[model samples]
Target: MKISNAHLRSFRNHNETAFEFGTRVNVLLGENGQGKTNALEALSFLCLTKSFYASADATVMQQHGTFFEIKSVLLSDKGKEFHVRVTYDDEKKTKKFTINGADVEKFSSVIGMFPVVILSPENSSITFGSPADRRKFVDLVISQSSKSYVENAMEYRRIVRQRNMILSEAKGKDCSSEIAPWNEMLITYGSRIIGKRNQFLSEFAPYIAQTYLDIVDERETPKIEYAPSISIKPDSSLEEIAAAMEQKLAKKKNDELRFQTTLVGPHRDEIIFSLNGMSLKHFASQGQHKTFLVALKVAEFFFLKERCNETPIFLLDDVFSELDEYRSRKLLSLAESLGQIFITTTSEKIFGGAEWNNERRKFFIKSGEVAQEPVTA
Candidate 1:
């Protein structure tokens, strides 16, 4: 899928702006604190229905405006056009999504319609960041690719929340009877999530390892392993898992009351990143970690392509300027081969005129205005 045009009104620094995008590479050049990244974020919000940097819609609205709107025309692989509009209001504290002029009741149905993957400079530190960051990284990518995984993950989180509430209310008594129903729901949804995650990683591991090997030119292999809170027994079906959870609930009744939170489930799952039997987070150099992050993202792009049968859109936020010449070239080369890519940079020098081609387009962002221009080599 590719975005043909994007219109931003009362968004960030932009009062009103509309610009057409190239089907291949489109670069947004500007200085720091300019609206280069904001334009990219606007496009991302249309596809993902959320902001990457801001937690609240108020953060994305113009300084003096109370509302923000983003409109885009997306062309699918089959030449079908999808018009998407997303509006946010602080007073109402709501986000509205419309596709083809019809309000979409469920956001999941709109996802994967115009799928995209983003890599920003912050992603470079993800491997070395907290476990929650890593889990979020994996979950966001996997969730976008599979709606079932998304639904199951959502249901699992809901069950976890409800069970925790019940634990909080059960003062000194055993909540075993009350927790049984939720435990069953958790296992049903949690197992599906775990199973899908495992399947994705099984297919994702080889691609990631190979890409890392190619980038590092090393003989050692990289490995990604799922570290779940509870060991899914070989003979234990979902029914059996639920039963085990129920038994564990009885055993840990007192502890649950003391902690006032649900424990022993997928909520505490993790992903282990290691290379040559050494944990990457602890042992890998800064450069190695960055390369690992890139490989993981590329593997995600390919995985989506293979699964969805459509080349997913790519968004790079000032990442080229953070990399060395060699790594930057490699990333741009890989991106050029993919579908539509929107890259933000503080300087045009990052492109270096080497990646410039007819299919690539360049735009200048100043304050809130976007000026369309072609790269001159």
Candidate 2:
């Protein structure tokens, strides 16, 4: 799917702005704080039904405005079109995500329809940052491709929250029986999450390894391993996994009461990134960290495409500056395999004039405004 047009109102610094796009490649050029990244974030909203970076709807709303809206049309390769819109109200803290003017019941229904892959500087944290960063990366990829996974993951988080509340509320001994229902719920939901996470890692491993090697052009083998808080027996069935989770949670009851938190589950898992059998965070240089991050995104693109059976809209959000000429060209060339790409850059000269198609529309964004940037050789 390709975004044909995007209109943003009161989002970030953008009070009102709209721009049409080319089918293959669309570039946004501007200096810092000129709304270049905001445009891409708007496009991400159209696809993902929320801002890619902002944690809450209010964070993305313009400081001077109380509400923000993003509307766009997505065109399929078969010439079909989908009208998508996302709106947020600050006072109510409400968001409306819709397609064809019909409210979307859940984000899962909206995700696979307009699959997206985003690569930005912040993604570097996936390599050098905490385990939560890597887990989020995993969830975003798997959720887009599988609706069942989405439901299970959401339910898992809710159960975790409820369990934590019970832990905090208790003030006496032997509250294990009080939290019993929550433990069963956790087993029910957490097992599914862990199972799906392991399956995704199994599918995504080779792709990441191959892509990382190609990006770094080095001999070191990159590996991604799922280290779950609950051990998943390879020989065990789903029922057996649930039983194991229940048993483990029962065993950790004393520790759970002592700490006032649920300790054993996928919520505490980690995605270990290693090269040559050593942790990437400790052994890799800054440049190597950046390369590994891009490789993960590139692998995510292919992973979603393979699972969803459609090309996902790829967003490169001003990350070209992190790479040298060769790596930048490598990224662009890899992007060419997909049907549509959106790039935000501060320097128009990064990719060079010859690299962009004359028909590939380029836009200059400034002060929340977007207009066509003329293509000249």
Give each model's whole-structure lDDT: 0.80, 0.84
Q: How would you encode candidate 2's per-residue C-alpha lDDT over 48-138 as one tens digit per residue?
A: 7777798888989999689999999998766788898899988898999988889988777777778899998888888988999989989
Q: Candidates' TM-scores? A: 0.91, 0.94
Candidate 2 Cα misplacement greater than 4 A, ranges: 355-358, 371-377
Candidate 1 runs further than 4 Å off:
233-251, 354-358, 371-377
| Position 367, candidate 2: lDDT | 82
Residues 272-293, candidate 1: write the lDDT tens digits. Answer: 8988889999999887788888
Model 1 pairs in collision = none
